[model samples]
Target: MEITTLASTWPAALTDPSGRRQLKPRTKGRTMVIDKGIGLHAFTDLLATSGEYIDIIKFGFGTSPLYPLPVLKNKIELAANQGITVIPGGTLLEAAVRLDMVPGFFRQVLALGFTGVEVSDGTINLSRGLRNDLIKDAKSLGLTVFTEYGKKLFGSRIDVDDFANTAEQDWSCGAELVTVEARESGKGVGLFDERGDCRDDDLSHIRSVIPNLSRVLWEAPLKEQQVSLIKTLGPDVHLGNIPVHDVITLESMRRGLRSDTFELQQVPFLEYMI
Candidate 1:
């Protein structure tokens, strides 16, 4: 007699949270975390439980310069081993620009093992020509390049035309995405009013020029900012400056698994692809 056996599978329990698809690596549905300083042990613990949910991990600011060489090397190796593209924060690069150490900085990065670089003038005056040149230099070093826009100030509101022009220039120079700066806080900055509400008119203005809107990553460090952007721009909008703990929560919000996007689930009914 022949017997058929079934594999045992447990359903998602009621005590657990909502359903959401974990994104694949190198996803445009990205969550870029700004790491100010996470020691080796804490970083390891973070990766152990949440590595799958993190896409890019940056060594925030020039804090990379302060870490013991061995510790930083180990951290970079660990993240890269798990296929996470590790890069130093753009502020660090801005510092390099300040010290005329761009080459030396990248030499250290390559020597220590980083797979990416961010080019931004958030804290400096990187003119259009120099910015493009910097992008080329980073690509020449075989780093995945991401550029950022907007100033890091309390009232640094975006002018849509300027943002669009800069974004196009950055893209033409080979940046993977242009990040809208929020500087670790979502309030009183780009796309956000004093209370952290998203500016609908600003988004509309940029979209009018940036045909490939998917390439713009909103730097949403707060929960409400992420929720608001997802609701307005759809689940596929790319977000940056996301805190490590909220990675899954951000993903849940994107996929309509959270209360914020529950209304988004009611799109115009369409036939299934199949």
Candidate 2:
């Protein structure tokens, strides 16, 4: 079976409302989708529809090991071919740590053609030294490492100073970026409050300490959260944990094609150059 990408059929100037949005091989404005067991056809449909807009596809929360080997390989290969980095969720690495199977996990991931790995301790208690070591190990294996800060439990919130410290070490140790844990629901954990609203103060504090906001990926799966973050961080903030069906919708919002951000890129002063 063959598949096609939207970019092949559409003209770039006509597709993007905001002409300033960067093309893929992009550093900023990355969108990472969470794949929680969508089948091969659906995955193909997603790439065919919005692959150019997607930067990463995370096989969520220990589910990478659940797929049939062929399906998993196909998913990774397909995403790779489209320039998307495919990674198993951080929780899978935490599980391996608990089972003393870290070596095997890295071995299997490389063998399976994953381009990256997420190293997190949302559930397990990992020491700072161990976390850095894990980051280094992944780097040595030639896999991009995405570290995570904050616990996965409900009511867990960001400690700005601690997050700054960890992010510094993670990046120094060679992590590609650090993700704030909002889980799949985008509620009651990390950046979100019980009602799913962002804790804006926490975000501000984190930003104050972290020199580069581009190195942070906010796991915002809800539409409202996406809009708020984009409005706050502008259209280029790295967002993760997006649902499969919402890929195009999220891409539309990112490019200011959606009403919520339609005028986001308009610089009124630029129109009146004297």
Candidate 3:
């Protein structure tokens, strides 16, 4: 299918009304899509269509190892050329740590043209010292390290103090951002309840306690969670685990072009700013 051009005349928020979000090249309110083994052609199509709205792309799980070397390199380069960062999933890092292959993983990531890496222990146990060392090492290698907070098990719960402590440590050690862990399914883990809804009370409480909400990327893969989060935290809340297809759709929701948020269409973009 042919891609549609985003002509400037399209009324800034006609599609994504959250016009306040600092578009491309911005650090805040970033939209990251998870790449779950989409082929090269489709991947190219996705970038061609929604590249403007995307900031980061994670090759979900250990799929990085599954891809042929040439294919992976091409994918990474293609994404980077469009000003979109390509990063290995955090779970992949956990596998590296498990196999004592952190160095190897870092080397391969750069060699394959990936611009970023995520250091996470959502499935494994990692001490603060090791996590900090990994963050420092990745940063030293010029890799944009996005650390993750929380476990991947079903019904995994988050303690505000623990998450806050981890966020502070990761940021202090030069991590670009900290991810709130929500496995790809977005269900029964991290912030989401068994039904995959963003637990408002939990989210509110965590927000109240965390000193830096901007540093934490909420893993909201569901549309409802995204809407609720953007509404509660305003349009600029950094969100992660968005589906590849919903990249532009989520962008629309953020910009207030979607039906759910169209009611706020009259408000000025500046009013949504912090």
Whole-model lDDT, candidate 3? 0.86
lDDT of 1 by residue, 1-274 (tens): 8749764754343212333344457555777777778788988987897787677888876789898999999999998888888999998899999999988988998999999999998889998899999999989889999998988989899988899989888999999889998878788998998888888888788777776788888899999888877777767678888776777787667656678877644345679997
Q: Which predicted model would earn the best TM-score? A: 2
Off by over 4 Å in 2: 1-13, 267-274
How would you encode candidate 3's per-residue C-alpha lDDT over 78-111 as one tens digit per residue? 8899888789998898999999998898889888
Overall lDDT per candidate, in order of appearance: 0.82, 0.91, 0.86
Best first by TM-score, ranked? 2, 3, 1
Q: Is candidate 2 or candidate 3 better by lDDT?
A: 2
Where does candidate 3 have its weakest 10-residue lDDT segment? 10-19
**Predicted model with the maximum lDDT:** 2
Clash count (model 3, backbone only): 8
Error of 3 at 138 (Å): 0.2
- What lDDT does candidate 1 reach at residue 151? 89
Of the two candidates 1 and 2, the one with more favorable lDDT, higher being better, is 2
